[model samples]
Target: MNLYYSFGTVLLLLAITAPTALLFGYGGAMATRSGVAPLRWFGKSYIAIVRGVPDIAFFLFFVIALDQGFEYLRHKIKCPDWNEPIRQGSDFVVCTAAKLPLGNAPQWQHETYGFMLAVLTFAIVFGAFAGNVLFGAMRAVPKAQLETAEAYGMTRRQVTRRVLIPQMWVYALPGLSNLWMVLIKATPLLFLLGVEDIVYWARELGGTKTPNFTAYPHGDWRMWYFLGLLVFYLAFTKLSEVVLSRIMARLTHGQATAGGEAQRKAAA
Candidate 1:
């Protein structure tokens, strides 16, 4: 019961976090498309820097940097009167009260913290790819539609809400669907973040060398575990493609776009 519960928790975390990351990525894309120069620069720089770096490096760098940053702030606040160098021999030592997940916390606490970090890392990395897709899709919105909305006395925000945003999804769906597929594949990286996910537990429980291993131990089984993960991802991608196709059809149903016109002509 305990093992299955833990495994279920991990899957639930990924299911919730992946969509949240996609939302952040979509927001990042919108930010990059802003007319204000500084906002545009900030969003563009975020996407460019994230996409340029290798994901593992980003994971390592961000985790350690964020951990140290949190500790540093705590050190300042909790020990204002007593001063000791924080960096000693390339190790960051802080008061016992300051440790995240703490020295004597339950294993579950540590697991939860690691899962949060993995989600943040996934969001930042995937958001860059999403930004590229969304930026292009936003631009693909027809200018005449915006003008038509204005002719109806709609303001810029109203035009965006009523016309541009709704229409942009059809154009963005192809790219966003591709991004979802990539995100599904990237879930394995949760192992790198120290979450005892399916990958981690599989190797631990499946490997032969450990004396206390369960009855399923076999020699050199890493390949099989990885193969299982690959199939899961492939299945997930196919399911997403089906959902996206349905959404595309619904969104294009009444529009004058090529897809809608095709549907209309077919019906006639």
Candidate 2:
């Protein structure tokens, strides 16, 4: 039950967040290519800043800040009349009632809340990378395609919707697929965000302590536990590659890109 619960939590969190990241990424890409200078700068800066940071640094920084920020807001809303001090030494103390999801909530609620936070963090960090991929893909789209759309009496919006976005995927998939792979690899970071993901449980279950504990208690075995995690990640990446490759083939069909040309030649 624990195994099923943990895996389900991770999968559900990923399903919600991956799409969110993709959508934000697409928006960022479009913004970067906007005709207005300010919009372009805004988009480009977003992509640039995120891409420039180490993923671990961003993860640690954002998670702590966001957690504290949420608690602060709760303190203001829930304890406005009773505050002595929110911070004392290294402790951030909110009134017991203000604890996120609350200490008295069921175990499931705490797990759910932690999972939600992990999803948000993943979406934000990966969205920036996705934005960079998407921006480059948008630019890689042929200028001629846009010009032709304009010549056909299409409005700018029509040109973008009918031509630019559709074709941009063919260019973007390679980069987006790469980003997806990175996102998958980064899932282990969920442990840092306080979710007991597979890696965390694996370590816990595999650890050896004493006969005073149980039959499984023996010696240090962190290496094998981590090796299993490595195997799981490698398998997941290989499966993802297969799926993305098929999508790539579908997207490339009849397009004016090299990938499309390869498909045409193969058909011939």
Q: What total of clashing residue pairs does each candidate reach?
A: 0, 0
lDDT by residue for model 2 (148-231), tens: 999999999999899988878778889888887888788878888888887778777778778998776768787887887789
lDDT tens per residue, model 1, 1-268:
4435545755676687667777877788778877889988988998889888787898778777777877788877877765678788988888877788788999878877877777777777777788788888888998988899999999877987899888888888888878777776676677777777777766765466554655554587777766776786678778888998898899889888899999999999
Which one is best on lDDT?
A: 2
TM-score of each: 0.84, 0.86
Q: Which of the numbered candidates is closest to the native, going by highest TM-score?
A: 2
lDDT, candidates in the order shown: 0.78, 0.82
Q: Candidate 2 regions off by >4 Å?
A: 1-5, 35-39, 76-98
- Which residue pairs of candidate 1 clash? none
Task: Give the distance in Å from residue 151's predicted Cα in candidate 1 to where it truly belongs.
Answer: 4.9
Candidate 2 colliding pairs? none
